[model samples]
Target: MEIKFGDAKYYAYTGTHDPASDLESVVFVHGAAMDHTVWAHQSRYFAYHGYNVFAVDLPAHQFSRGELLLSIERMAAWLNQVIDQTVGTAFHIVGHSMGALIALEAAANFNHPDAGLNSLSLIGFSYPMSVTPQLMDAAQHNPSEAYSMMTQWSHASAIGGEPVPGFWSAGMQLSMMENSTAGSVHTDLIACDNYAGGEAAFVKVTCPILFLSGMRDKMAPAKLAQAEADKNNNAAIVLLPDCGHSIMSESPDGVLNELKRFIGARK
Candidate 1:
């Protein structure tokens, strides 16, 4: 479904099998250069099992139309606008990678008072999400090379394991990056590198927070996420073995099971 938020058209996959009313809304935010399709399995599963799912395409990414927001704070604000325009109230939220950082900031600085958040799930995240200078330079000066480096680091192997069988997952990631605007990945990496609000955010989060970390993730490792998870009283951490940073794809069933249990308990 498409919804107008200012001049941009935001696309969300509402459950194809269910009605759009009386069900609690769950918004899924994708990582940098990625669209709502990353949550393909989880979103539909929740919607089919009785929930209103909003797996969103952020501005300037695949389906959403607008200039890229450039910073985590701005993206978080835009996400708030998305929630206000669509669900208009209390909702659960899930985010991956860069999206997880955005969700953390949003939960810390929630704008809606009367209709507060229910719970938050963050996948593949780390506080002060530092990026290597070599990668940053590649993203800025040589995007194609940066994309290549990203693909190399994203998957467990060159062929990847069963995220979307019969297709090259690493190649798929490279293709997906092409859908983003020029320098979008660079901007996202910069935003993640500059963000220092995780410590402040976790302390203020009043609702439940679940962190899913991949044991084999080369990008954002399990220990980094676990350290952040320890800061919050309501936070709990889960580690998935034999999984890479692309937990949603690398370990789709594991992610869904964790989400099912986390989201299910609140409902």
Candidate 2:
């Protein structure tokens, strides 16, 4: 479904039901060079099981319009707009990779008179998400090469675990990145690299946080994720064995179960 946030129209994957009438809403944010479909498995699950799901496509990504926000701060602002325009109040937030950083910023810094962030789930996240120079250069001059590097580093093995039979996870992710607007990958990489507010932002978070990491994650390893989790006294860290950075696709059931448990306890 498309909703108007200022002049920009945002696309959200609402699955079989709309969130217009639901009191409980969950917003899912995708990583850099990715779209709402990354939460396909979990969004559908929540939408039909008594919760409103807003799996959003970030600006200049897939079906969403407007130029890409180049910083985590701006992305958090966009997230606040999304919540205000849609649910209009408190809601649960889930984010992955770069999206996780955005969620953290939004939870810590964003303020809305009519709404508030209820809880946060950060999956495959890191504090100082430093992007390698080679990846940044590739994103600027050759996006295809950047996509290749991302695909390789985003999974546990060279051949990634698929969400379904005959559907290759790494290939699907590559296609999604390839479809992104020109220079978007570069902008996203720079955004993650330049973000310096993570530790500070995390310290200010008032809600319960769930930190989910993949033990085999090469991009954001379990140790790095645990370091971030350690700062939050209210955070519960779960490490999925054999999973990679793409936790939703690589270990959909595990991720969904953890989400169910976390959101259930809060609700």
Candidate 3:
């Protein structure tokens, strides 16, 4: 689906399901240099199972058109605007990696009392997600190398252990990053590296939260995510064994089942 926010057009994959007022809504936000397609496995399931899904492509990424929102705060604010215009009702938000930080900030500062935030699910996330200098440099000057490094590090095994039979998880991830608009990886990495408000935001969020981490994640370690979840009264953490930062690909069923339990319980 397409909507205009100011002069720029924003795009979201709705699993080919048209939203209705009676249906509950859920929005899925992707990690850096990724798009709505990352949520392909989960979004369609939710959409067909009575929820309205908005798997969004952030501005300047994939199908969305606009200058990149250069910081987590700006991305969160823009996300809120998108939510207000699209869902405009009680909803759940699911975010991964860099998108998780955006979801954290948005849920913390959520001002829509009428359109409540039912729940938040953060996957493969960490507070103050630091980007390595080597990765940042590669993203800026040698994007292919950056993609290679990220793809290698994102999964538990570099060879083949994808949840989907015969599907090349690492290849897909690399292709997605390679296809991103120029400078988007560096822009996203800068946003993640510079953001410092996650701890504060976690304290402010009142709704139930799910911290879904991968046990073998080298990018944002599960320990960091657990530490943040520890501070929240209404939060739970689930660690997926033998998985890495790209939990959605390596453990799609695990991710889906946990989300169903978390979001379905609230409903």
Report the number of the highest-lDDT candidate: 3
Score every model by TM-score: 0.93, 0.95, 0.98
Residues 227-253, candidate 1, lDDT per residue (tens digit)? 888877788899998777878877888
Which is the leading candidate under TM-score? 3
Which wins on TM-score, candidate 1 or candidate 2? 2
- Output candidate 3 Cα RMSD: 1.0
What lDDT does the true structure give each of the candidates? Answer: 0.83, 0.87, 0.91
Full-model lDDT, candidate 1: 0.83
Arrange candidates by TM-score, descending: 3, 2, 1
- Write the residue-wise lDDT of candidate 3 on 153-241 in tens digits: 89999887767779988899999999999999999999999999987898788889999999999999999999988888899999999
Where is model 2 poorest over a 10-residue stretch in terms of lDDT? 15-24
RMSD per model, one decimal: 1.9, 1.6, 1.0
